[model samples]
Target: MRERRTIIDAGWILLLLIWSVTILFPLIWVFYESLRTNQEFFQDVWKLPSELKWSNYRKAWEAYGIGRAMLNTVYYVGASLAIGTFLTAINAYVLTRLEFRGRKLVWGLIMLSLFLPGINALVPQYILMRDLHLTNSLTGLVILDSLSESAFYLMMLAGFIQSLPKELEESASIDGASIFQTFFRIIMPLSTAGIVTVAIFKFLGLYNSFLGPFIYLSDPKKYTIGVAMYQANMIMQYKTDWVTLFAGLVITMVPLVLMYIFLQRSIMEGATMGAVKG
Candidate 1:
């Protein structure tokens, strides 16, 4: 039994090491490639550059208009995060804490929607956006992203909320707190872990979103990072400047990587806390 356990542990460790290498190698290669000139990269794809062409980054930034796109992305992400987080929190709180007619049916419909592919609604959504004249602007994107419901985040928050002690809510009520007061002042504070987790997920989704922005936005000035990256890739066909494209890709990853690094612990905690109830 002891020998078998040791063998299993060794197998798991080896598998993890392989997994780590597979994930890290591409990132390492991309960064290294980003330092080389297009000529150098095409000549020797596997070899390191003799000298780093740091100007590739500057060229990419200027050529692709990534700065403007990043600013637009920040607006979309910020607005979506604020509006979506608040609405999701309220939706979770209502579903988990309140008693009302058709509540289960509403939740069932939400859950059912989760299994449906979003692509199925693309035409309808696009038509709606076009009709509202929101197809080309960040405000329109934010409204579309925020107003839609996320059943997964809702369920996670609902589960976490359900796990909280009932006495706290009762005590708040006994102390003359209204439902709104109890939610904002007491429940919201205590649910920080879950909220942060959902916010991070939402931010990542919004930031890396390509499909929505690609379809809705036509102007280069209003493009997000995802669309900007696509534009960079397209430029490669004409310019053949792979290094600049790589540099843009690297820049695009920095914000998301930093965010995950900072919030990993909270994300894990929220996942665990939510699982405790359901």
Candidate 2:
């Protein structure tokens, strides 16, 4: 039995290594390619660069407008992350912790969206944005993103909130604390793991969102990193500056990767502890 378990563990480790390589290879190759000149890349795709051309990143930032797009993404993502996290936390706390009429009905209605495909709502959302004259605005995008709650996140947060002891709320109430006070002071701080997890998810999704920004914003100045990279692809058809594009891709991925690396502990704890009710 011991020998069999050891073999099974080894098999799992080997499978994990393969998966890691599959994910990391593209990122490493892109960073490698980003250091090469376009001439070197086209001459021999497999050969290492004789001299690193770090200027590709500068060119990507200045000529291709990646820097501006990154800035746009930061503001778009930051604003929505703040709004969405706060709103979702409060909503989850209310639904799970507070007693009120139609709570289950409201939750059911929200969860109903999870059953339907998101593509079905795109046309209607576009029309609403256009009608509101919000199609070309970043603020409009922020508002839309903040209000559009994810059922999965809501459920995760609700689970976390439900697991909290009611004794805390009762104690807070004995001291004449209001619902708002209890939530802001006690519940919010205690639910840090779940909130951080949700924020990271929101941040990553908003930063990488392409279709919404593509459809809503026509102006180049308003483009997010995803849309900017897409525009770079279209321009590359004529110019073929692969190295610069590679640099731009690396630049786009770095911040999010670093964020996930730092917060992965919180994310793991939240996902595990929230599910283990007993």
Candidate 3:
């Protein structure tokens, strides 16, 4: 029996190792290659660099004009996460806690939208942006991403809010607090887990967003990391300076990787708890 248990543990460990390698090997390879010069790439792509090219990062940063791109990305990500999370929380609060007419139909409509392909709306969205002269603007991008995310987050947060014990709200309300005060000061604080989960999701999407910026922002100066990376690859006519490209790629992914690593536990617990409606 002990032998069998040991064997089972070994099997699980081996499977986990394989999964880790599958996820991490690409990132490791990128790091290795990013330190190599263009000459080294042709000589032996697999070989280690004679000396690490730390300056590859600086060159990539300047060449891609990633300073401006990063700023734009931060604005887009920060605004979308802030606005989207707020709207989703309020939407979920109303749907789960408050009495309202046509609520079921409203929820049904939102669920139906989840099945619709986002691509189907792109052409129409572009046309609307053109008509409104919102293309090439930061505010337009933030609004678009915020509205784009409403349905999914609303459903996720609604499930979490519905699972909370009603007694808590009742007890708070009995203390002479208005409904707004109860929600803002009491319920919203308890719902932080769900909010953080949705915020992380929005941050990932908005930070790495490609399609929206690619279509909307024609101005090179306003490009995000996604667009800037694409241009870096394209400028060399598809044979991009591999070292610089890889360095830029690493820089682009590092912040998000660190963010997830730091917040991963909260993200997982919140997401799971949010979905587990009683």
Task: Write one digit per residue (lDDT tens) for candidate 2, span 26-114.
Answer: 88999999999999999998898999999989989987788789889989999999999999999999999988999989998988988
lDDT of 1 by residue, 1-278 (tens): 99999999999999999999999999999999999988888898988788999999998899889899899999999999999999999999999999999999999999899999989999999999999899998899999999988898898888888888889999999999999999999889999888888898899889989999999999999999999999889877777888889998999999988988888888888777767765
TM-scores vs. true structure, each candidate: 0.97, 0.97, 0.94
Q: How should the candidates be ordered by lDDT, best one leading? A: 1, 2, 3
Clashing pairs in 3: none
CA-lDDT, candidates in order: 0.91, 0.90, 0.87
**Per model, how many backbone clashes are there?**
0, 0, 0
lDDT per residue as tens, model 3, 204-260: 877878999999999998898899999998887856588998999999998899998
Error of 2 at 86 (Å): 0.5
